[model samples]
Target chain A: MWAFDTIFVMEGMKMGEFKFISTLASVKASEVILDALFVIAIGVIVVFIALILLTAIFWLFGKFMQQGQKTSVFEEKGVNNDTSSEPHILPEIPVAEAGISEEVVAVISAAVAAMSADGKRYTVRRVRRVVNRPVWAAAGIAESTRPF
Target chain B: MNSLLQAIVDIWNESGFVRLFTLGTGNNLWERIASGGIGNLIMLGIACILLYLAIKKQFEPLLLLPIAFGMLLVNLPLGEVMKSQFNTLVPLTEQEYANYLKGIFDQSYPVFEMNGQYYWQHFETGGLLWYLYQGVKFGIYPPLIFLGIGAMTDFGPLIANPKSFLLGAAAQLGIFATFFGAAALGLTGISDLTFSSQEAASIAIIGGADGPTAIWLTSKLAPHLLGPIAVAAYSYMALVPIIQPPIMRALTTKKERSVVMQQLRPVSKTEKIMFPIFVTLIVVLLLPSAAPLVGMLMLGNLFRESGVVERISKTAQNELMNIITIFIGVTVGATANAATFLQPKTILIIILGLIAFSVGTAGGVLFGKLMYFFTGGKVNPLIGSAGVSAVPMAARVSQKVGQQENPANFLLMHAMGPNVAGVIGSAVAAGVLLTLFQ
Candidate 1:
């Protein structure tokens, strides 16, 4: 942020008092060129260092996350292999009579049958409305007063 | 009855209306205009032109409109709307200079010595706009604007491809280039067009192409030039569509422009949350001078990403940003009082600012080309021009130019990487300069 406190001190001096005052003030083409080149070199180096540091840090983080995921996957596989020794039991899930149109259900059932390769008869279960937030609300726009 | 009538007439004679008509008084309408002279008329015309550009042309109307009105309001005769205070511009008299030097070493003396003698004539209490200008004059508004920008900005693209940071840094070429250019102008023998190092540095930052950063730096380095610098920065930003395309085309071949970049990996929510914090830590530690801008920006981003402060994030993005923007625009405009803005140096600043922006664009594209060559055509050079820190605008220009080469080439997301990086880079540049000067 720009602060006003420094305004008084800076204004009291001319040209903000450059460290290489004499060379810049004289406006000698060669000297000015040298100073500018020096500044560019230093500025570029500084920016590159800061940005490159960030890049390296993020790269390392990505690697660490990947490694952690790999370890978790291995642990999950180990648990499943050990559990395979026992008989697996499937729990029955309760079904509800959902209010779906007969014709729509028939169409959906037929499509699912057509795509099935093993030819297992399936029953059309239920239909429900998907209650989801609108895009504006999800994006934190309180109401639907958005122009677009 | 006659005595009462005489008393009434005496009261009328002493009123403001009577004072306005009195030819020789300071409040006289004619004398007020006369005091401002031809410079005031030119500045008024300039303000009108700015208004036309803002209202009709729609060039950054959110900012330009307020700025133009401020310019118009401050330049009018007898407005008493602005006063020349000791900003970075006004040259100190010999006595004032001595006192100023003494004040630096002598803690007992006030920072400003002979303040009355060095200052321009105006009302003792200052004018209405001057009061409003405190936000800008004291350097309070820009950081708040940065907070809003932070809440609004998404760093996902920059985080997805950290390499864009180099492009962002490269885009600051114009700033340093323009600094040299402004100093070079001093040797041209036009006394009115010459720039002090401070003025040149402030003017050079116009190339950074970020409005708040430009205004912030100007307020610190050359507060007097804030009006022109802000106008030039915002105007060029608005003109990005016009200014950037040709430069992008000229810099890259058709094949280079048509090159399709690899899809960026999906950024996880955890990464998004950590990005702002990591950046704030890295940047502030590297350059503490950037703490206010970079820190506030990161804080705002944290607010948005944390998902815990939805209300504050929304306010920061919308209400707070809008309010500060209005104050910044109008108050900054008011600083362009006729006497200061009508000089030849103002013209030089405008010209140099454009040059700075152009050079910055070129620098980014050139760096992109270098990266492309190294990466074996993996990076599209077109996205490099987005490094000038105009945010979505520069990125859009890159996409537009790339599409012209290949109709199916959608470079927006890829371009955004450098685009957002440009913002960080420019702020860093400002921090660097501030550190150097301050």
Candidate 2:
């Protein structure tokens, strides 16, 4: 444990006052231990306190932002709900007929789910293969766009 | 023929080779050693090894290569690449006039009258490296580097999960713990091993795991220890992937490591823009001593997030960053010339640095376990080790280690929160140390 008296003595001292006990040779072993402990306590406590304050501030900020986002989402949903009169229909594509594996369809659906905001689930309506570009061009595009 | 022979001898005597081998007109082995030739040879050897590491091993080559080259340049005998410039007042006399006429002194040397006495102000120019080193010495380059880092860094992760800030703060345990370790080592009472509190603080900052912060704090607190401390700090940073994993794995079980954290909520554009500004105001208001490093970093981040200063942000992260990196690297390396570097204390500093890094990693992971326990294992303890700020490297290490346990786990973004938070934490820690010591 750190000695309170040492910290009190240090508190009253101004800058450069610690120069006297800067080196261990000038002070007793117990005093050096106490000084070092005091430093450790203060340093760790201050860092934690500062970061905790930041955490609290940002947590509140995050909550506020989330609330704003929720409000906007609700407002957008209200308008959409009021305007839509027709029944929504999904043209379910048969995986075997479309020449796509069940796993591939599931993967595509999962990707769509991942990208969806508000966690709204949507059924996969169809799957189409558009042969618009050569394989080399596709490879080049993939190569160029790959994340670092 | 005799005159020509004498001229050839004069040229030989004036050459760096003569200075390398002989001392005060003596050419004995003892004289050569006494003349600092042997020390320079050792330094050159060390520089070559560093060069090999930078080139072949690819250990932080961008900075290490320049640093090694600077070391090589400064250690060359009679190179005077780091020598200081000085002006001397020489009394104008008949002999002095004769010497000047004979070109012994530069003909351009200015002559002036001082106290009714005529004098020549003979200016001796400083070394090239000495001028460049002033950027590092005066605390200029580190903050500039931080500006570039700020521009590149995405604090969105940190902002999205603010609790990661605690892990960041926890990672700084290494620094203060090392401070205690350093001070405790002083209790050994060995004459060569004793370190002052200032020296301990400088050495302890290596635990911050941020090179710029380490250099900034060391330059301010213990300029003499800058060489070894910078070398140790960067070396340890490069070793993060290797040094961190063992500690990370040891601290957390496979189950804890595999615990996949939920993806962070998407931060709004307004929130992203406000993050840096809010951080700057709070951090600077609390610790004004951190203003230079933290303020510049936040400014750079604002440049990036604001999306208005695209050109300036690009320059900060790319071109300006490169130039300052070269200058800071070479000049800081140049400081490691024979006298200051080849000491027992340097070894202790390196050892203490490793301890600081290890302790910091352990501290972050342990704190993460506490979070995991409190949150009922929702927080993967593996991401805690990323709290030591080595940027994406430490975070990537967390991801890699976690993936080893469970391939589906993606902790990179989650780990990034603490990773960047570690940067802020270290800067704040550096400020606290500076306030206490400086």
Candidate 3:
């Protein structure tokens, strides 16, 4: 049998004798230390490399995010929709009258007027008030915690 | 009247209480305690200490309580809760090994046959704890536990700042360092206590600070050491408050600790949904061994983020997670029978596990300093210590220490970036080890 000075191979391996090794025998002291060092060196490198790959992928994904922002801008400008030739026509949204105080409406109108002073046209068509707690909040769940 | 009195006295002499306490058959309390051995007593004492920590101190009580109770149960005399059905530990003769295999695998339902002769057996069905432990032995509970963790994790912080992945990768220093420490102990000349390569691998994983990963890796690499490794991993996790702060303070300068980070840009919902799928593909393709853990974790995250399966996601996080945690705790606890637990190797594992965690924390903080210098002090080095993979606990410690330095600084969100990254990092480290060893 092939052997080293401190090696004491347990009974499991055999020539043409398929036996599984149940317990791993200890190696020489030097060998153990060296093997451990080798594992640490290689393992650390592997971890960094794997993470680096992930970072690169995410960076690439950031480029796609910029593109998505541009796409949303186009949609806002009616460039990617059926109303591209008719910005004044205004896409209609169905609405129902909602409970709101005149003071609240006046405040919203003032806020919109302040923004429109820079020649940006804007409109406020409807307002609504929430009277009851959401179902999740009533059931003792928080919105921030729901996803987790 | 005399005949009736005599019959009653005979029945009293044969009662279970008399059998239990009588000295004649060696079933008395004194004899039972003596036969239980010094190891059994020691383990029982350890179990009691663990229980006090778990119940009174609330030290990861969900897992520690079950494990300590399991330890207490198995160490008691005459409790067959952890006894094996067969003498599998002793060396079996060639014929005996064949017979043992035949008994378990053949069509004979708890019996073995040889040359038209039959013998009754219970190889597949042992103690109740043994039956429950199959979930651990076959590597079932850890992945299921990961599913729950997945459902519970919010990857938004990690997705918001993907560079936190590097800090997560850095904290795995504990696993590799402890591996070296365990092997180095072989030179100490304690033959019975020396760790083999496999044992060292298992012990080293205690530093990963991820309980499920530690258990899963132990079940495969060093099946016998699963109890101590799992216990060490979870105990250190609960002790995060005690262990991580000192290391974090030591590694970073006052200026580095006080560096306030800029707010991370908001991540889109599409990015959150794509994060898990892309991670699953990249990790599994690169390291197939990580599939079991990383795959399940991603699947759970997908269930949560997909929004279509809220019920299933909630069930995974609550009911399924709770059930598996109980099984994993009790079964892993039962593995620490007095005979196996009260050994020199177990003590070494405990000590080395602490060192591993400490070193891991330092590694992450030091790496954070490097990132701080590179980024022109934009990143706080204190949050780097959260890279040790103890989840929100490590992250919270970062926040606590940061707030102490600068009352206005809030590092919770910033620390969470690396905190969640550490989870993926440890899982990846585990994959690397499993791939290497397997």
Candidate 4:
């Protein structure tokens, strides 16, 4: 029985040795260089492939998102276009033959008087409409090109 | 007077000072060196030097301080903070059992019979560090650290410019190159200098220039080399500003460095939210082994971008990150006990780590030059060096170098694209290595 047990233990030890050799330990000096090269080529290639795939996916995703933003911006412009297409209604301000109306001048002077601080009397200045980009378009540009 | 003198003599005999000066008897020089106190003294000195670097030089001090203190704690004689636990079987007689029933013997250990004999199973308690080390041993802490990093990072720049992903991939050249270099070192026929494939993989990851990723991969591939590898990774990462510039200058022309690229397009909030989800799906599908690190990172990023979990994101970034950093730092440092770390292999690892960092930086810059050529001088090659995933530090180096050439140039946001992309790239490379080696 003791002899049988000793043989059993020896077999177990031999099996363990075999397992160890089959693993990393089995790579001989000659094969180490080849193995390292194999790992480098495969590792670099795999990493590049993975990242490149990500680049393609995200690039497409960016395009899709940009298209969506453009569509939204156009929709906003459509709303502004609808408002602009409506009939223009000029405000009721009586116009003189050449100069400004007296009623408008009186209203402007009263407005200036309402804005006076320290209770000092102030003169009415001329008012003019400045031509600029529409509010919606300017807002869209600012939203799209906001810097970091 | 006689009793006092006797007490003093007894105390002196029991003191660690006595143990420190004692020489160990062994059959061989290596064995004697390990068993004696001199090795521990040398380790203590090394620990002190690291402490000086961490404190005075501010070299990644948040983690380095705890790691150095842990090393100091472990090397002190009689401080069994990291001792291993084991169970022993003691053969017990029937009479001893009866005495135990009568409370004559201690009953803390249970008595049991195996075969024809009765034995007591005595369990020994392990040290404190041994318990805390389970997080690293089970590969838990690094992923959690990734989670915090994800929460803190903004992937907007990367989303705006996807080509940066290629630069990220290119920077990993150092990792593979060093793998071959380390394995080829074995051809020199120096027995101690040779490395197995796993050791080579672990050392090569130092080129990734990511501390948590390096730790995560090392713990899996080569746990024994964790101490030196972690130290080398963090040291090189801290030295990124110094190491990357010259390589960037050497690899690119003055005009290429001066190229001021157009600003990156604004990334929408919805795109930012979808990015983490899609990246997680694709990366995990490609390499399931990387799921832990990459998944946790995405989850943390999701927590930030989803904007619904502000509380949880804050906790992951602040409290949870700080706690894990402490646990990982100290435990990883404790692994550098003298017997394992005092080998020639460690010095080699340190040198190879520097080479890996330099090569990785050069690869990124070279790839940047390639992009500059292909794009008809639209791309600034300096930003390519930021692809090594040292994060904002690498990006800042790009910005600083570009400013030196053209003060009007701002590459911080642009370089951030590749900087963050490098994080994902290294994690992917880590997954590939784990697949091959693990």
- DockQ for every model, please: 0.22, 0.34, 0.27, 0.27
Better of 2 and 3 by TM-score: 2
lDDT of 3 by residue, B319-351 (tens): 999999999999899988755675567778899
User: What are the lDDT scores of the predictions, listed in order?
Assistant: 0.79, 0.86, 0.79, 0.86
When summed lDDT is taken over every stretch of 10 residues in candidate 3 chain B, the lowest stretch is B17-26
Per-residue error for B206 in candidate 3, Å, reads 1.2
Model 4 DockQ (Cα-based): 0.27
Candidate 1 per-residue lDDT over residues A1-148, each given as its tens digit: 1111122222233323543345323345555556555556656777778878888887777667667778999999999999999998977543323555677767777887776643456665654445467665666764433322
Per prediction, fnat is 0.34, 0.60, 0.46, 0.66
Which structure among the candidates has the greatest DockQ?
2
Tens-place lDDT digits, model 4, residues A1-148: 1111111111333211212222333445555555556678778888998899999999999999999999999999999899987887867653333345677767877888887643567875455333368788888887676532
Candidate 1 runs further than 4 Å off: A1-27, A70-148, B1-37, B84-124
- What TM-score does each of the candidates earn? 0.77, 0.84, 0.78, 0.83
Question: Over 4 Å off in model 3, which ranges?
Answer: A1-30, A74-127, A130-148, B1-35, B85-124
lDDT of 1 by residue, B36-97 (tens): 54456666788999999999999999999999999988766567777544334344567766
Model 2 per-residue lDDT tens digits across residues B108-196: 87877788676898888999999999999899999999999999999999989999999999999999999988878866767568787
